[model samples]
Target: MKSSFFSILQRIGHAFMLPIALLPVAGLLLGIGASFTNATTIDSYGLQPLLGDGTILHALLTVMKSAGSVVFSNLPILFAVGVAMGMANKEKQVAAIAGAVGFFAMHATISAMLELNGLLAPDALPEGSLGMSVGINSLQMGVFGGVLVGLGVAALHNRFYRIELPTTFSFFGGTRFVPIITALSYMFIGILMFYIWPSLQEGIMHLGALVNRTGYAGTFIYGFIERALIPFGLHHVFYIPFWQTALGGSEIIDGISVSGAQNIFFAELASPNTQQFSVEATRFMAGKFPFYLFGIPGAALAIYHCARPEQRKLVLGLLLSATLTAVLTGITEPIEFSFLFAAPVLYVLHCVLAGLSFMLCHLFDVGVGQTFSGSLIDFILFGVLQGNPKTHWINAILIGIPLFPVYYFSFRFLILRFNFKTPGREDEGQETKLYTRQDVNAAKAQAQKGDQVSNLIVAGLGGSSNISHVDCCATRLRITVINENLVDDEMLKSSGARGVIRRGTGIQVIYGPHVTLIKSNLDDCLHNAV
Candidate 1:
């Protein structure tokens, strides 16, 4: 049962990746376009007309603005689609239909509430009132709404996908039933949001104002708290306050101002009266440039170099992939997780560096914002979009250069100093190699003949009763045991586990990508043993 639950969680994580991948691209385009607008307006002298009346330049500017608007305006739709796709079982078509249905339902519900409120208030209704727009209409759509839609769709899909219908209603059976059920489910969701969303929004805005009052200290706190909450996927809650509130602008809630990195940056770019303040204050986000564009890759290189001589080739390939991902999209998980659990000290160092980078950028007044992390893509976009693009961000690339080597060498020295068990630095005789095809076939044949390798593994790991959790992802079997001491190293080795690693309160068994299949087999063995 524990194994089954873990398997489900793994699938959910995999599904989420579908939407997460597209975010970086959206972020890149939005950042670039925003930067272009800022650059053209702030440094119009550098932007000359290519032809009469500067039609080409005007067209280019229009396209950039359109791209920015699309991304910002349709964020809710993106979230809905992303959630639906991530939560589906087999047919993504069902998920897609459900997403669209949910979007419309929420919007319609909100609009209805607005009309109802106006009718009830009559004379109290404000003049020139426009009805509320619903669904994932803007960045205001919120992650909570996306998750609600995804959950509703997944539940409907799983419950009704195979249900037999009355003959009269047979036309809507199976896949066709998905959209109907999804639409009905969202009706309640919409009604709920209509009444609840306003309070939630107000609360978030209030929180933003309180944080903004902390100023630079507040920014540092936000950065620290954001990184801390990443493991549980709750960082979005912490982020929305700054991104959506007025603290960073002239907007006020309960007579208090709200200012966050994104809010401040946008205000600086868009508000004519406050353009100068925006240029200087936007630097709160600039410090991340070095960390994203150079520091991370440098760390990856360091890890590759510190790998054992025999393992260098394999580790190099892994780090190279991770490095490119970090540089392009600012998704650092693949690289960060590589050593985070194995060598926690290094992870702490990374967090510290990240905080410092944000602080230094703020101090230097180099401000930029991207949908993702502080990568080269955002750097260019933010710099180009600045009110005083040349004055504030000229030194970004220069900062990144020295920071790269500092990250690389520092990571290398730390790994060596601590003899950390990162990747290839495992203790002697600890290396696990993939079995040859012949060897695997031989094991399977022997198993049929009643060889007890499978049984032995179950017993050695304290049987089914001792297993608290069992999960697999890509290349490893993530397990939690009732008692860590019950896992015998030699017994697991003989049963074909390539390697074993223990961290605080958890253990990992390496079996490469095939670990999932092995995990299923192991589950069966443990269950039968019980």
Candidate 2:
């Protein structure tokens, strides 16, 4: 079967997620480091005596924060490895080597090309330049460079992982050829980028300036587009540029500059404060805190309240869990999808209100950040722990409080008034069963320690014999089975699945953010199958 454009994009999005999982700890460490290092924070709070300079506490805290700092500092490499790992079907570690090689070569070659052309400099390079240690040497392609190298390496891995070569050069065939080709291929890419990037950086800088100049309006537009595009899984397209490129990235933090919004925030947090935290630098992010931490969950309450009293129990478990997930981790698909199909108008309204939240937060000058999503986890790690008297992070709550009512009254009234068929309101003809405690225990036992979840999921889908192929993109595990009758939907749900969809002999097992792990586990299950 031919894949569609949507499928290709979904796969790329999944690839993007491979490295995103590293942000939370980085956020936490950076927050703590920033809070302590700020002479004002300690002096104002009167912790000056204990956390003063030359104390072990201060030194230890600095070390802890540096642990997280290095991850973002080397993010270009992370992206290359992540994209390679995500795209490769097998021999992932080998592909990663190719990615690393390609990335280094691309950046180094670009640097050399620039030096030759006199278009670049070691001292006065552009702000988006990748490496300089504040001066500039090489490897300045940033996230865009990382992506190019990753894609290049992955394409080679997938196409030539099993290619044959003449007997004399057989040693260079298969996995061995990957890194060699990656290095050679990126030279051309580097040459192209050498000429293109200066102009590209200018364009990106202008775009970033445009958004920055718009201030609150730009934030609202970003929030609106982000939420609006969620249903199509294109929200990544809306945010990635802002998050990764010079557009919304490239802020100085703690003395060391960084790229990407979240990384910049963490980096900024750990750096010594010369001035009050800059809201302008963090404008792309601060608004999401309110929407994710409070506003969206308030919408969940509105949904539950509007659910039919009789069927409410059936959905309460799912809704509550979904709400908690949104509050804690900032994953909202379960809750969003609950009403997205039934009341799409409400989704539009949600996006608009979310936009309003962003605009309001910006106007108040409240700023905070998170690595992955907007959640209370972010609230605590990036907001509360990284507290500054000057930062209006607490204002997130004030804006968030109104949203609950806004979402509740609006959704409740609309659902009742227009008869939106959200959740419990669905016709009795649609049969639904929430995963039960008994089902949970069964799946848990079946999914053993090493490959427990993987094996149980395999069993649910009728095991190795029944499954002919397996692949995943983002939230769902896409599988091909020989017989549909052997697949058990309840079993899959019991195996910690969010949901299941079947089309012919193809099945999709929804697993939310951990789908990558599940896909790996499933692969392991097949490798160890009985």
Candidate 3:
């Protein structure tokens, strides 16, 4: 049961990575375009005023804004494709195509159901229904709807993909059967969703209201739970709805409606009335900036200073890159994972302190937004670029003053008093060797081709007979084998894996962002080998 739960949670996390990876570029485009096009920013930064209307730079900025906005606008389709690919064990293309068909069919079916129920409208549904806008005879189900359609297709595709058909129906035996099965299943789902979604939407609205009413206390809880759930890989399920659904926060800007706190903030920032919205509406994102930019790096310093003197040298490089990752990109897994396995209690303390920081930021009305992590990059683009009148950027410094020391000293005191392993103090038998990006790249170069890398990875994973399933997330190759004992960790490392993780029959080979290509190559190699 534990293994099954872990497997499911891991797959969800893997699915999230696909959409998550695209956010940084989108965010950058939005930030740059917003800053350049804003009259205030352009004037303050001394951009050419005469070039503003119909000029090349203005046209370019318009393109930039459209590029950024389109990603969020069409997020539903992206989620559908991402989730389908993430969940598929084989023939990712089949699952993705089926997921697309299922998405449209489900929305159409839901539209028909709602029309029959007399609840449908042209531009909006009755209150307590999903969708940002209404269309002819139907409303868009948004990202939440996309998630359901994707999961449905994946389930159907996985179960029936290999089923044998009678000779007369052999042409539709394999991948061809996936979309047919998915579309049929989703018709039933559409009917069910039409009835269930209203209440579900109402519940989500009430929950959002409760959180909003709680104010800073709500921010604290959100920040704490978001970090706390990372170990179990369930944080995305908790936050994405709040980030994308109407329940999170929504606003109609410049004759267009945008949902989610982040989306609303960006829309407002790009519009002339960036300062018009309530700062409190941005409470979700505001709380995270201080913790990511100040508190996490301090925690890293504490861990490093307390490490065994001899081993400190060994961990210094790890600590540096991990600290930079946390501060710049808001990616804290490297830093958090460093201490989580070594000192679980300390991890909880970290979460609690993070929660406190969130509350403090909200209490001070520090508003900021991020597409990815709450890193320095977002702090500058979202908070600083928009100027202090809107986001209260200086309040981050105020919150960070006490917040940083609290994380640093608390971590230090606990590590020393309890003699926690932290990182450098681990037992001799535990795997202490760390691999860097350079190491992975070198491994890749040594192999020269993806096939060679895949071959080595396959050999390391105990080859075709041993591997039961193969899949990948953003940065890791998720594989399951009949027997874990047959896997060779050294061979995997040499084959370009930065690290190897094992949980029962499940194994994940870490290879950073290039993992998708490696997974594709590995799939091909496995096919040819068989």
Candidate 4:
């Protein structure tokens, strides 16, 4: 069951990645359109265009804006299709159709409820009157709604795809049943949303307002909590306030507002309303630029320098990729996960740095927002379109360069001082020795002797029965065992694992990138043993 859950999560990640990868294209289009508009305004002010305003430029701007608008408007549809396809095993087309059906069903259902509520007089209606407004469209159509649609579609597709039908209704058998089931399911979902979505939305807005009222301290808490909640996939809950509602968002339409840290920041950039506290509240995010773009990379450099002589090159390669990701996209998972399961103290340090960065940015009033986190892409765009256009964002980069080195040296010194077994710092006996062909042959000969090394590993961990779940990512066998303490580290090491890690009630065995294959082998071993 644990493995299956992880598998679902992996599929969801893949689904989300597809649409997310396409976002840069949307950004480029929007940027170009904004640039064109700027150029046109400048020309109107009697400035001669180096590249004259021809039909070509005008046409290109129109196309880019149109494309961007389409992408922005249909994000929910894109999400549904992406998620369904990612989750489906073989019949992607069936899943896609189911996704579409599910989306429209929820949309129609929500629209109907709002319309119905509008018909009833206030005195005759329930308190809050369902807070349902017709033609109410949310930014990105709500991630939760998209996920529900995808799950609904996938479930229907999987369950009804092979169901036999009466001869008269045979046409609706198999994949065809998906859309029918999806439409029906959404009616119930719509009714639930009518009663629930308003309160949830208001609650989120209240939370955002509360955070805003806390000022710099609130921003610090938000940043720290966001990082800490990552392991449980609950970061989204905290992020919703900054991204979805009016409290932390901007008034885009006539009466509607959009909130989220990014939303608020962008709203401030697009239209600065100094009177509104929400717009001014975005200063909290500005301080994060230096830390994400520089400090994390600096920490990576420290890890590389502190690595054993033989492992320095390997560590450098890993840190390089991780650093590049942090700088370009603000995706710090690859870097964070490196020491997160090893030297937890460093992870805590990262959390501290993150909080401090936000506080400093808020103090300096240097603000920018990104779709992801504080990465180079968001940094550049936000800098160019800043509310405080006179502020020197370049200074943030200048400050970051030396800061990176400081982080590196300090981390190296601390790790050495504490004798922490971070990555390559393990004792000689615990070190992983790579095997050549000759060594493989020697090990094979030893295995031929009455030495069941694999069985010993299983036994040391309280046998196959003890393993409640097993999955993996790039470098570790993520396992949920009956008792984390039952797993002997020495036995796992003898079986060729690089290391063992524990978090809460979970245990992870390091097997590098090949951990996936190891997880499969272990699963087979367990099943056969049972």
Candidate 5:
């Protein structure tokens, strides 16, 4: 029972990646365009002649900003399609289409109910109580509504995609029945949400208020749990609500009330009337920048310095690459998993420091926002470019610079004192590299030939017969197997996984940020094998 629940949680978390993946480009376009078009920014930089109101540069930037804003604006529907497609066990494309169908049907039903209740008028409902969802005047359920539709539709899709029916209804028995059932089911759900969501919304608002009232401690706990869940691959599930819904707090941006931390930050970014960005909305995000940009690299440096002298040269390149990945893109598992399995004490310390970073940033009122990761790209686009007056981004710098040595010294002490077998200190003859590379060339060669890496992974997973599900998150290939005992951890490691995490039926093979490619190859491999 525990395994099944863990498997479901992993699946839902993986499902979130489909929509969350779209944020980077959208954020880039929005950040650059908003930065250039802002009157304050233009005048501050004295580039009026080149990028003034009527200039081509200004006009183009305006278009760019709008393009980015549209994605954020439509995230609910995107989540609907993404989650359904990600969660469906079969007929994924059909499930995706059904997700959209259900989303529209649900909102349309709620809109009808609101109009019937005379609650659709401009003043009929309290401000921010009734808002739009894909142009439907509906209750403000936010991304939660999209998620509800997606999960419900995917459940329906999985149950009925292969279902048989009476001869008279046989035409709609299989995949066709998915969308038909989804639309009808969500109509009832919409009616249910229409009646109950108001109270739920009130409760959510109170929860957000309570979270806000917790202030520094709240931010620390948020950051702490986010880092703590990394090993479990459930951090996305933990943070998505704060990033996308009322749980992160809400504010009126450009006369439109925007909920969620990222939403408020972006809306404020696009608004010309904005002065300083909202620190409250950004507390959930600013904390990541410091740790990702500085602390992780510091820890990497400590690992390198602690390596055996004879093995230092051999491990330097690997450590540098891992640190660079974390610093530039905010993907830390490569560096993290290196010591996570070897020296869990350091990981615990890292999580504690990460929490402190969040608390400090919140205390300083740093307002830096991020799209996906706290990479230098996001830092420059959303923080540096937005100006310190708005983001107080320099505060993150001030907080982070000192954290560097703290991480280095703390990690160094822990490694030496505990004699933690971190990278180079491994027993002689064992590879000193973090996350093994012994099979990289072989894995690449196999991938180029026919993705035999997938075959090895399949064998490692005890063949397709024992496997129940296969999915992935940002940096790990998540799977579920019937018999965990049959799984070979060493085989998966040799197939290029940095590490393997096993909990009953659930397995997560860490493969860094490019796990998506691995997942794609495995999908093809599985198809051919079947």
Candidate 6:
């Protein structure tokens, strides 16, 4: 029962990656556009001639900002479609269409309920009780509304997509029945929500208030658990609520009530009335800057310096590339996985430091925001470019600089004193590099001719016969197998995977950010082979 529940959670997390992947680009557009277009920022920098209202640059930025803001504004529908499609096993496009129809149906139904109850006006209901969903006057269920629709529709889709019916009604059977059923289900859900969601909203708001009351200690725990879940690939599931729902906190910006940490930060970014970014919202985010941008690189450097004298030359290029990736892109899995499996104690220490980073950043009131990860690009666009007075981005820098050496000296001491087998410190001929060149080359050579990676992955997972289901998340190919004993971890690693993770019948093959592409190709490969 526990494993089943865990497996479902893993699938949901994987499903979320589809929509989560879109955030970075949307944030990029919003951050860059909003920063340069802000009147105060323009005047402070004395760039009125270049970026002032009505100027060509200013007009283009306005368009960019709108384009980005639209994504956040319509996130519920996006999550609805993305999550439904992601969770579906087959006929995914059908699920996506159903998700959209259900979202509209649900909101429209709620709008009708409001009209019947004489609660259509904002003043007719309590403050923040009435809001819009895709222009439909309805309860402010936020992303939760979308998720509710998505999960429900996906379940309906999986159950009905291949269902058979009487010959007279066969036209509505199979994929055609999914959207039909979804619309009806969500219409009922909408009626239920109209009656129940106000109370629920109050509860969520109070919960958000309670979390805010926890202050710095709560922030520390948030950061600690976020990093700790990396090994299990469940960090997304852990962090999304705080980032997207009322659990993180809520605030009013430009007379608009914004719930969730990231929403508040971005809303403030877009509001011309903003004097400064909200520390309450950003405290959930700014902590990532220090650890991801500076501290992880420090740990990478430590691993390099501690390498065996003979292996130092070989490990330099690898560590350098990993460190650069972490510093610039905030993709730390490569560097993280090295010590994660080698010296778990070091990873624990890193998590503790990470918690402290959040608490300290909160204490200092650094109000940096992130599109997705704590990358240099996001740091500059959202933090540094937004100006020091507004974001207090310099405090993050001051705090982050010290973390570099702290991670360096501490990791160096721990590595040497404990003789941890991190990277180059591995026993001779025992997988020293993150991945072997020979295995990567073999996978590439086969791919040049055909779907070699997919074939190899199938073989590595004990052939197609052993597989029961397949899915993927941001960095891993998630699969469930019938026979765990048939799985070969070494073979999986040989197929360009960074590592193989096993939990009962569940298998996750780590492939970094490109796992989506691999998944698409593997899906095609499986279809063709079938």
Best by TM-score: 5
**What lDDT does the true structure give each of the candidates?**
0.59, 0.74, 0.76, 0.60, 0.90, 0.86
Model 3 accuracy (lDDT, Cα): 0.76
Give per-residue CA lDDT, model 6, range 1-530, as digits (tens).
55556667778888888888888999998998999999888989999999998899999999999999988888889889989998898889999999999999999999999999889865888776666788898888888888889899999999999999999999999999998998888889999999899889889888878878899998899899999998887888888888887777877777777778888899999998888899998988999999988899899889999999988887887888777878787888878988987899999999999999999999999999997789899999989899898889899888889999999999999999999999889897775676334444554566677977898899898888888789987568989888889999988887778788887677889876567667887877877868
Best prediction by lDDT: 5
**What lDDT is reached at residue 399 by model 5?**
96
Off by over 4 Å in 6: 435-442, 449-453
- Give the Å shift of residue 472 in candidate 4: 8.7
Weakest 10 consecutive residues of candidate 2 by summed lDDT = 431-440
TM-score per prediction, in order, is 0.66, 0.84, 0.85, 0.70, 0.97, 0.96
Per-residue C-alpha lDDT of model 3 across residues 220-300, encoded as one tens digit per residue: 898899889766556777778777776676566776656667667767766887664345566767778877778887888
On lDDT, the stronger of 1 and 3 is: 3
Error of 3 at 411 (Å): 2.1
Model 4 alpha-carbon drift over 4 Å, by segment: 1-18, 39-55, 84-92, 117-141, 229-241, 244-250, 253-256, 263-288, 308-318, 384-406, 429-530
Q: In candidate 6, residue 229 scores what lDDT?
A: 90
Quote the lDDT for 500 in model 4: 66
lDDT of 1: 0.59
Of 5 and 6, the candidate ranking higher by lDDT: 5
- Model 5: colliding residue pairs: none
Model 6 C-alpha lDDT versus the unseen true structure: 0.86
Off by over 4 Å in 3: 48-51, 114-137, 254-257, 276-281, 308-314, 426-435, 445-466, 472-529
Tens digits of lDDT, candidate 4, 199-281? 77667557656766888887777678767755443354455435433445334432334334544443333332322223234
